[model samples]
Target: MMKRVLVFVFTSWAVLHVRAQSFSEVTNLLDSPTVGVFAVGTSIIDVNSDGLLDLYRFQGTFLQQPDGSFLESSGDIGFKNEDGSTAEGSTVFGAIFGDYDNDGYVDAFFEDLTAGSRLFRNRGDGSFYQANQETGIEIFSALQGSVWADFDNDGLLDLFVGGDGDPSGLFLNNGDDTFENASANVGYSPFRNVYGVAAADFDNDGDIDIYLSSCSQFAAASRNMLFRNDGQAGFTDIAPSLGLDDDRGGWAVVWADVNNDGWLDLFVANQPVSGAGIESRPGFNRMYINDGAGGFTDMAP
Candidate 1:
């Protein structure tokens, strides 16, 4: 199934094209804008079931107001950093929102390189507290990728974290606010510098498969990996046979039905950021077309 590369320049069903609109920059902040406190990621979600979306940055949070405006409520919600006046804070590499405890509220997870990862449990009253001791999630590395989904169809969302310099971890929700380390149990505890991760049922097998956009530092390349769920909470590295083991510096991996086919296809962004050592392979983006028969064909031109 050597199909031609399909680039998505527009949506699948689009007729009328419109001109791009311009946006004006907003330079206002609550505390005269504490300058820069290393704002990297933001999660806009309905944190309190108010039907209005709220915002959460690493430095603080911006709660939506009734008048369609944003109010700085980071300090009030207990999510703000300690130093913000003179700009002395670190950056949050990645964050995700999920109600892992089956609660009515959504919780947050933040990954910080210098300060380790943290799990913030939502108090259902617009406030949150760190719950690393309660959830059994304590990872520390150059953390980056984070994804939350009910991969096992267990009715609760599971958590996966990718980081450099150590093996990434996967946490399976125990359905009662606590979690257990499922990385080794699921056969996916790869000791690679994992930067990206995503899940999809590429084979239409009723179970979700995982894709790890992994790359190593210090000249050694880890390549990418795809773990097919065994439907029994187990996984197997089925990357080589599917042409998914591209040794380029895998950064981000995403799968979609590119040709509107029933089977899902994959695309990965590559950019090696190795240390002062020679990279193992050249960095280049890759596209893999699912052949619908437990295999993939590289469709990149």
Candidate 2:
């Protein structure tokens, strides 16, 4: 009986290993050369209004087919420059899809490190056109993450872009396919090296609040900020009083009701300082639990 049990276990393990080996590699189907590099952003959306979802990578865009394969379509989809050239060496970071003009078609937004940001408006006829200049939504800075939300309870969607050295821009929708820069007027002054941004109503109020993650290596004090909406088309910084003022290197931020107690909480991702090698100590990730009132406690110990 012992011999039979051992044989049975060995046979089952061998069959599982063989099955795993049967799955072959199909990555060679992509036309681009595999350079073993980090990709900044990837978004899956139907670019041509087709039933199939398409892939948008920082390197280029790919369209999905019925055969479960993707074909590069960045040039065909007008993601290149007006001179019919791609951003060869530029670093593209974030990509998001939203109906900015309420045209029933999802438009695309791509954030670049140095080449500025681009907005691609989707035409219903299965094509996209760069409308950043026309829409008055251009930002000439090192942009990182971007988010779209109706902060002022407006019917149209507004845009918030996080920057590296420049102050983050908040573009309020004018309902006419154009935007007005309202960053200074909305209490986003004294900007640092902003990285990621998240927008949600933490106080259960009708207005949306803003949370920005900042990072730098200048030995300058940097802390993540939270701006509360005043419901009068303005915002107030309430992060320092809420115990969120820390000098850690912040990267990304996310807000959600983690405990499901009808209040929203914040999660921040941190990293070591720039140029800090493996010998440097890493920053700890934090989770700030929100009380039913307006206070927050760092539960990351």
Candidate 3:
């Protein structure tokens, strides 16, 4: 009886030791640490219908996180740390993912900050192929404001890009792996150095109009321009009459229905107002609220 009891005690001790080892292994995996490096993904959207907004971030590599917090993979490009050593080449900003090709997989449009931007068409089997070279979309050379909209009321989506001093590009989807450059035809050319752009059907004409923010510097002379869509390749500039010229070099503009009157109001953010003139406010900001009826009132000092 004594011998049997001793054998049982030894067996139990070994079992407990093995369990502890397994627990430690699991804990170590949970503590697996990695340093995040890039910040290109400035926009978020729901693509996979998983009820979570996936992260379309650029950290020298394209990273897709399902829950917006946890990373699933870095795609073909790898992740790199602070050290000079790299895992991926470069990435894009102003990125939006959607089924642009109707291939049932989300495609990517990212600004190549180091060079030109890129359009990456996703393969159905969890990989991506580059489309920038073939698409002729030059993202890096432009000034960096981009918004994707289905302009022209086409069944397919198109790209409306805004840049600084450089004319914006409109890569109209041809629906056949080709895009047409309609910037000049669309009245987006010869524009002053534009920074940010937003689109809305402001006049409620069943089509979207465009608003752009322009500034010489952060505080120098600047103007906010409005382009009203006249339905087929025609636009009119209505910024001056809209009282939007009262700007200390506008930086960002958005349309909001401030009075709940069903009409969209314009909101403009300008340079700091606490200074003497436009030069006084170095990095300060102001806002201009539109009162409708084609005029804007200053709401910020």
Error of 2 at 105 (Å): 1.4
Residue pairs of candidate 1 with colliding backbone atoms: none
Cα TM-score per model:
0.81, 0.81, 0.69
Per-residue lDDT of candidate 2, residues 58-101 (tens digit) = 86878887887888877777776657666422678888888888
Give the number of colliding residue pairs in candidate 3. Answer: 7
Q: Model 2, stretches more than 4 Å misplaced?
A: 1-35, 81-84, 87-89, 218-220, 274-282
Clash count (model 1, backbone only): 0
User: lDDT per residue, candidate 1, 211-281, as tens digits?
Assistant: 98877654345668888887755788888877787777788789987776557899999885545565546
Where is model 3 poorest over a 10-residue stretch in terms of lDDT? 23-32
Task: Rank all candidate structures by their TM-score, best first, as comma-separated numbers.
Answer: 2, 1, 3
lDDT of 3 at 204: 62
Q: Model 1 scores what on Cα lDDT?
A: 0.74
Candidate 2 achieves a global lDDT of 0.78
C-alpha lDDT values of all predictions? 0.74, 0.78, 0.60
- Per-residue lDDT over 1-301 for candidate 3, one digit per residue giving the tens place of the 0 to 100 score: 4654464566667766887774323212212243464554544554444455544455433233542344434434323334644222354445666676667767767644356666766666545667877766655564546666666776666777776655667677788766777887866566755666778877666677888877664334356678887765356778787665544566667776555555567776654445433344443354545544655676655
Ordered from best to worst lDDT, the candidate numbers read: 2, 1, 3
